[model samples]
Target: MEQPAATYPVHGPSLRKRRMALGLTVQEAADKAGISRSYLQRLETGIRERMGPKRYTRLRTALNATNDQISPPPEIPTEER
Candidate 1:
């Protein structure tokens, strides 16, 4: 059988959306969050999984996101899927 594409563990508030709302560019936001633009880009695009919790927290703060606004509980993957 053909396996399905590997989706991320969860869908969360997009960093890109919030950054746009705040009128910030990826470079600007990444600078504020003390990360590289490419890293932020990856996070926004879901190309990276499991950004470090501490760094994620910093990013949430830099983006001025409330816990409810940003945190998406991870989806548990089932073996038989």
Candidate 2:
């Protein structure tokens, strides 16, 4: 049997950069964002499973991230038979 390839969420780098630019620590940002420190850490490390639109919006707003600072994942083309 062959194993499946691994996939990682894309928000980690954006989150880390925004937090750093704001001169905020992980705990501070997490607290301001109403999420747990460990949860934020995991998200920042790409260890979290996935991200939804709502969560992305919230994180973006909470971090005061600009549009250029955050980008949605590229769309996967659909297959047609």
Candidate 3:
């Protein structure tokens, strides 16, 4: 039997950058955005890829970030199995 390929979510560096730029701690940002600190951390670290529109909007508003900063990075193409 063949094994399935693994996939990773797009990395989001802008999230971390914006948060730091605003001088907000992970917990503070998460609280302001009504999300968990781990969730915020995963988003920043690319562990979690996609954020729903509501969550994205909340994070954007909390970070005072522009669309560019809140948006996910361009996905890299992966080779077919």
Please, what is the whole-model Cα lDDT of each candidate in the order they appear?
A: 0.72, 0.73, 0.80
lDDT of 3 by residue, 1-81 (tens): 975335323246888888899999999999999999999999888888777767777888999877766666667999999
What lDDT tens digits, residue by residue, belong to model 1 across residues 1-81?
985334323123466778899999999999998989998887777777446656777787899976555545557988995
The candidate 3 region of ten consecutive residues with least summed lDDT is: 3-12
lDDT of 2: 0.73
Tell me model 1's lDDT, rounded to 2 decimals.
0.72
Off by over 4 Å in 2: 1-9, 72-81
What 10-residue stretch in candidate 1 is worst by lDDT? 4-13
Higher-scoring candidate on TM-score, 1 or 3:
3
Clash pairs, model 1 backbone: none
Candidate 3 lDDT score relative to the true structure: 0.80
Better of 1 and 2 by TM-score: 1
Number of clashes in every candidate structure?
Answer: 0, 0, 0
RMSD each, Å: 9.6, 9.6, 8.7
